[model samples]
Target: MRTTYLTIAGRIRQELTEITQVVERVQQIWQLYTSTQPRGNEFLVDATALNLHSFYAGIERLLEVIADRIDREKPMGSAWHRELLQQMTADIPGVRPAVLSPETRTRLDRYRGFRHVVRNVYSFSLDVEQIVPLVRHLHAVDAQIQRELSQFADWLEQAAGAE
Candidate 1:
């Protein structure tokens, strides 16, 4: 049976798959970035930074889809990225529970800043120091998002079943 929860959850699930792909690709890039000797491996680092940028981009895309589809609202203005993340932590009165926690919000906020830097600067200009923590901690955010979304999906499935 078709239901609102199924439709919403279906799309979010597809997004999680896309994020998994980004995670795989980012992992490969990180391996290349780390294994190569730092002395002569500008290319590897640059590749990693680009992929890191993509990682955040993919997550933002997923959030945008969820915001538009389930929340029925798209943030407006120059700071929409921040607002969208904020929205995820909010409980919309008649809509749905917050999709993620405030702690996740704090972590994702860093990437939001990183994403901005990646966009505004050249890849070669990326600082290895800056990218290091993001790479190191990527899996934590990935897991957190996966766990949160999975629970949401279960809730959605139950809602669908009830309907």
Candidate 2:
């Protein structure tokens, strides 16, 4: 059980690292898109698709970890998983506002829906058009999450010093 927990934790950390890298790359692409003012939209669209794919991949990995833990009959592990999810959600501000931001919330909700489809429906595919907007929203949320993680790290350091 301990090894299983460590394995899950390591996988989660690895996925988080991948998520950060993809988010950084998306930011770079966004910068290039805005700075150069590219003549054609094709490249920009392709970059957006790639960014979305990475974002979804990260989320899928996270859900997989949660599912694995549940399958192993480790409900306590889910508390940490839920905390991470809540932190991810709270880390993004306007991206998924507590109230009055149905569209943003729905975009993320689709991920959960997709997980359900994977687990239950078993015959679902992601269409490009359906995922693009969600990716755009995720880009916005990624910025907020980056900021939140930085702040949280600083808070942790300060608390550790006090103790």
Candidate 3:
């Protein structure tokens, strides 16, 4: 049986909360790094990498739920992650509007790529330069995602009530 729209909306809100937590942790790590800049702590750098990974992972989790429940299908294969992201930008006739804007998808793709690198490499090997940009942009990305997904959730809730 298909999941109820309200149920999916609740899941989306929960994932948004999780993503916010991840963003907060990443901000903390960035602040710590800046305070001790010249010293360059490896642990802080590694923590940043992990939190960044979590941020993208949370987003992917939200998208996966939408794709499965609302869209009625999830992409497959080794490139499914990228495929799923792409899928969210397409407005499906008679189903639902696009879950993400193209700009949001583009911004998210950066985190997705970073998550891939973090997964394959040793935390110690993570470059501070790479982590810096993602950390700086985290807040903006978080805000955009929160706005987009919350709007989507609102739509789901309305659809649920009408059923």
Top candidate, metric TM-score: 3
Write down the lDDT that model 1 would get.
0.81
Q: Compose the digit string of candidate 2's lDDT tens values, residues 1-163.
A: 4455445545555666778888777667755655664444446545745665566557645544544452332224634433334433432332222211344334555554444333443222334365445555666665444444344334434433554
Off by over 4 Å in 2: 72-107, 110-140, 143-163
The alpha-carbon deviation from the true structure for residue 30 of candidate 1, after best TM-score superposition, in angstroms, is 2.0
lDDT of 1 by residue, 77-145 (tens): 999999999998998876778888999988888888988998899878888898889888989998998
- Best-to-worst ranking by TM-score: 3, 1, 2
User: How would you encode candidate 3's per-residue C-alpha lDDT over 1-163 as one tens digit per residue?
Assistant: 2247888888889999989999999998889888995866889989889999999998999899889877889999999999999999999998888999999999999999999999999888888889888988889999999999999999888877776
Candidate 3 off by > 4 Å: 1-3
TM-score of each: 0.89, 0.49, 0.95
Candidate 1 global Cα RMSD: 2.0
Model 1 residue 132 CA deviation in Å: 0.3
Candidate 1 — which residues are off by over 4 angstroms? 1-4
User: Which 10-residue window in model 1 sums to the lowest lDDT?
Assistant: 1-10
Every candidate's lDDT: 0.81, 0.49, 0.90
On lDDT, the candidate that comes out on top is 3
lDDT of 1 at 94: 69
Give the per-residue Cα lDDT of candidate 1 at 18: 82
